[model samples]
Target: MRKLARWHIWLGWLAAVPLLIWLGSGLFMAARPIEEVRGEALRRAAVPMPLSGLVLPREPVVATKLALVDQRGRPTWIVTDADGATGRYSARDGLPLGPVGAAEARELVAAAWNGTAALSALRRFPRDAPPGDLRQSRPSWQATFADGAHLYIDADSGAVLAVRTRWWRAYDLAWGLHIMDLQTREDSSNAFLWLFGTLALAMALLGAALLFRRRRTATGRRA
Candidate 1:
């Protein structure tokens, strides 16, 4: 029982570290509404897509999905084929438009950003090697603002992929700590996580046994 108590005490301290990380991260993530954390208001308001003189894709697209969107004051048709390949075309003339170039990517970010700080830098990330701030595997352009806000644009589709702030990066770190996967930040069932979780449960059981034993001893003394 004494050895059990000592083990429980040490294990409890170890468990407390991750539990506190989980608690703090949960509070920080929940402090603001999800939309605000995502910096939705920093984006320009959407004008109704003007497709009055609409023309469809000339080539036969085995389309799995399609969207009519406004691209830099022009109507664009974003097409996704059955094999999950995406393409962009002009809705006005059915002409092929993207794989977005750097200059156009700059224009796209400028038009989309409604924040006060001016754009400080623009960088590109390859499909295989992407910024940690971005969640997608596709190639992208990152427009960074003076305020530490980063807006990611799809290199192939010219779409706004994600908006991340400094706080979001902190949240991401917290998530990695909470999940015990600081490397990938996605693994929830790693060996370290399971081992620590088992230790925490054992500590709790040991604590309960100690409490029960003390209560019974006190009752017998009173009797």
Candidate 2:
């Protein structure tokens, strides 16, 4: 009984060092703000996408082939088939175009074809009464363009519910750092985290083994 008690105490002490380190590190990591980490990561992950030319419409057809120019001014074509018919070699990488419903097709045209006109119409629409006003306002979602323009979407139907102008602010450098995991978003998904955990566990186990061996040796001597 004495030997067994001594062994347990020794094992626990051996495990104590690694156990302490693991607890301390985990507590520190958990204390960090997730939002700060996410913003920094977004900033670091930022990269410019190549600009493709705008697709211009040719006719008043429900759907038309859109003409586009690459960054180098080279022309490329994409079919904006809105008719919802599955026609081969139409556009979007030779995918079928057209045969879509009239209403959906119209919405697509309004969004892609008449970008400027759509913005103007949205601006002219009267603003909904604020919260607690006499008139009830419908809930909506919104997307902001790079040029400070906003396209309010219907939350339920995912439709372009409205369009308007709004403020725009770019993410700060810290956000980029967080996104990249360079400064803020600790590379928790990487092998390093796993390595650390494994090492900690191993150290704890090793300490326990040392304690057991010591107890066994002491017991044999007493016997």
Say which candidate scores most in TM-score: 1
TM-score of each: 0.90, 0.24
Model 2 earns a TM-score of 0.24
CA lDDT scores, all candidates in order: 0.87, 0.38
Backbone-clash count (model 2): 20
Best by lDDT: 1
lDDT by residue (155-197, candidate 2, tens digit) is 2222233333321112222222223333334354555445545
Off by over 4 Å in 2: 1-22, 25-187
Residue-wise C-alpha lDDT for candidate 1, range 52-138, written one tens digit per residue = 679998877789899888889988888988766788998889988859988999999988998898899999999999998897788
RMSD of each: 2.0, 17.8
Model 2 CA lDDT for position 128:
62
